[model samples]
Target: MLEGTEAVLAAQLRRLLPHLDERQRRLVMGAAAGVLGRGGIRVVARAAGVVESTVSRGAGELDRGPELSGRVRAVGAGRKRLVEADPGLIPALLALVEPDQRGDPESPLRWTVKSTRNWPPS
Candidate 1:
């Protein structure tokens, strides 16, 4: 449908988010949710193309004291990368992916012939 309410709101948020830093984006999205009141977090999040938690953070921020600095996030606030935090992860992943250059026997492609005829299933 042309000019639907949800579509217009989503477009606005998509257009706006790129211009804002992380914290500002959260606050803006949160405010949008706050305006809607109750379940606004879900609506604003979907419209803003962000997770519900992000919107929730913004809403929580609104209820608290003013921001103290220009920091976008708290120290070590987010999750760590799998590769960085666990060295064993690489070995484990490589073992699964045929680390020694030999193919894994359990792979789905193990029995499939590597040919163009097999590629498109002619």
Candidate 2:
């Protein structure tokens, strides 16, 4: 299930449908499933009978949220980031680690160089 912020986000997305073209509106509804914890773009697009790029674009726009309220949506391939999609994590992550010892046991997950994929299994 989606958290409160996500539910609000999904609601906001549904509210934006009236402003979109038919194709874009279909894309927005597809992307909203992922926002509501239904699934990712692949599944959403498949369910909506639309192209993955369409859903991807809609998800990208939703990510921008109300910040782009009056702006026109841009057309392009979106960039994939190395980090998870949650926007509230940066300060939490930075607060949890020091500059030099980030790879140390300070991380709650305790991931380490010793746990590197190439390390021989015991």
**Residue 112 alpha-carbon offset, candidate 1, angstroms:** 43
The lDDT for every candidate, in the order shown, is 0.77, 0.58
Give the top-scoring candidate (TM-score): 1
Q: Model 2 over residues 8-119: C-alpha lDDT tens digits?
A: 6545755676688754675566556555564566655554555778777767666666444443444542555536566657777655443423454655653323445855
Reference-based TM-score of each model: 0.58, 0.33
The segments of candidate 1 whose C-alpha lies over 4 angstroms from its true place after superposition are: 1-3, 78-122
**Candidate 1 global lDDT:** 0.77
Please give the RMSD to the true structure for each candidate, in Å: 9.2, 16.4
Q: Please, what's the RMSD in Å of model 2?
A: 16.4
Winning model by lDDT: 1
Q: Write out the backbone clash pairs for model 1.
A: none
TM-score of 1: 0.58
